[model samples]
Target: MPELALKKETGLKKETRSEELLQLVVFQLGEEEFGLDIMQVQEIIRIPEITRIPHSPDYVKGVINLRGKIITVINLDTRFGMEQKVHDDNSRIIVAEVDENVVGMVVDSVSEVLRLPLSTVEPVPEIISTKINANYLKGVGKLEDRMLILLDITKVIMEDAPSKVAYC
Candidate 1:
């Protein structure tokens, strides 16, 4: 009876630990995979015609009207200094809330919703090199086959205060 109680207690602890997992919306940007906290993502939609804003920052792709809400769109490729690629059928806009502002991030494609244990995430290694600015990275998530670059969406969207997109 004591051994049975111990097993039950161990199972409960395991369940509690699993609850610490980070749920992410994973997407592809060029050849690399990136993830954003799922809580920040409002929705994912197919790419729509975007209205360009003249004199906007180079990284700003422009704005899209999402059900009467004008959401500013940022091209992650341009923002990360990667070669821009033409949008295709797989291209998607991830609508996420950052710094109290809702914005759309254009990605090559959205892969899947992944739940990774917090223990699997590691701080950015000093030896690792990448095109993305370190300040925009939260951490690197290790998976069985590949690693996922976890982006700090707040830093990516709000880095330039003066150039912050104003939504109506």
Candidate 2:
């Protein structure tokens, strides 16, 4: 019957779509674990010598010359309203490309690459902390005992980041 054929086609389409999985680059920010789309990340590099820019935003740590290309580096901890700590051996800069901008995000450390089903991700709740700009979140992904907070790279870099400098 036509109905049976249509149902089979629809089921096939659903299976095809469901097969697409999200690949995340996991990292640690203080005690919390966060993830970003691996496709958005160009590469991860050690904390290089950063040249501070005059009159730059508080969250903007400065610019770094990676290999030969200069890239703007943002302090993720400060941007999230977390306490600023001195960079250590574990510190790393995740070079991310969102839209036309290629910037380095300084995180405490890099963890691992996670591949999970898209269905496991859930949108953030209405009640969230003001410290972190919730509008920039993709969702929280549940995987066994791990709860990963997925951040929207575009929104976080383009929208939530403070444009003004913080006067010390």
Candidate 3:
């Protein structure tokens, strides 16, 4: 019957929509775990020699030459107003595209790539207590035993652009 066929189609659509997944490249900054959309990330590399720019913001770690391309690096800990930690062997640079610019972020370590269903992601909480500004968060991803702070990379990179002309 037409009604039965229509019901089956609608059920299939709902099932597919509910199963949609968001892939993220998770990384650690200080004591918190953060997730960035995998599509935005270019690559992950070990820390290299960075050329410090004079008089730059404290969050700017410097710049690095990546295969003949100059990429600016940001220290997430300092940017989030967290205590700075020494980089060790686990330290890594996450190269990502933000607002048409290729930039790198220094994180304590790179964690596993996560694939979370859309149903698990919740909007930013009103009382969420995080050192990082709420404007930089996309949402909070809830897992069985843990949670991930999803980051809006564009906001993270351009938060001060209006006031900081040097960063533009």
Candidate 4:
């Protein structure tokens, strides 16, 4: 008699190994690295000229017109309680969807797209740096030499602000 094999998730017979992986768009802030679920990322682009929003917190970098649509952008540095750094050639804006809204977040640089087994992601640990709100972290992704701080996009975008932005 032959033994039947099954995939770890989804009781269906295994066809290919591709569906069992998690994808992430990795980026950097100051000296730390972070990641977001790839599905939340729309696109990444070079930092553009941003128009200041009056009375808004310093973290709110402002807005930009991307292909004729105005999108609000924020500074990840300030949002994480770090000193704001001037935009350089390596800086970029990662456009993403959070809670049904579009937002562009500035990062030191956009790194590579990482794909790994879903099991490699672990729940948020008890202690982390004080700069970012732990509620904003999805989990800590374990990699070979480093750990990727996975972000909860909705919280990062909606909670860490002067107030809920009223962009239409």
Best by lDDT: 1
Model 1: residues with Cα > 4 Å off, grouped in runs: 1-9, 12-19
Error of 2 at 120 (Å): 0.6
| lDDT by residue for model 4 (12-127), tens | 43534655777899999988899989999999999888898887776778899999989889888988898787789999999998887889999999889998577888988786
Candidate 1 lDDT, 38-110, residue by residue in tens: 9999999999999888888888899998999889999999999999999999999999998778899999999
Highest TM-score: give the candidate number: 1
TM-score of model 2 (CA atoms): 0.84
lDDT per residue for candidate 2 within 1-168, as digits (tens), equals 999999999999999777868999999998889999999999999998999998777789998888888788989998889998799999999999877678899999998998978988889888876588887788999999989899997887778443432221
Judged by whole-model lDDT over C-alpha atoms, candidate 1 comes out at: 0.91
Quote the positional error of residue 13 for candidate 4 in Å: 12
Tell me the TM-score of model 3.
Answer: 0.87
Error of 1 at 150 (Å): 0.3
Give the better candidate number (3 or 4) by TM-score: 3
Error of 3 at 166 (Å): 8.5
TM-score ranking, high to low: 1, 3, 4, 2
Q: Local distance difference test, per candidate?
A: 0.91, 0.86, 0.89, 0.83
lDDT of 4: 0.83
Ranking by lDDT: 1, 3, 2, 4
Cα RMSD (Å) per model?
A: 2.2, 4.7, 3.4, 3.8
- Model 3: residues >4 Å from true position, as ranges? 1-18, 162-168
lDDT of 3 by residue, 62-130 (tens): 889999998889999998999999999999999998877888999999989989998999999999677
Give TM-scores for every candidate, taking all chains together and pairing residue i with residue i: 0.90, 0.84, 0.87, 0.84
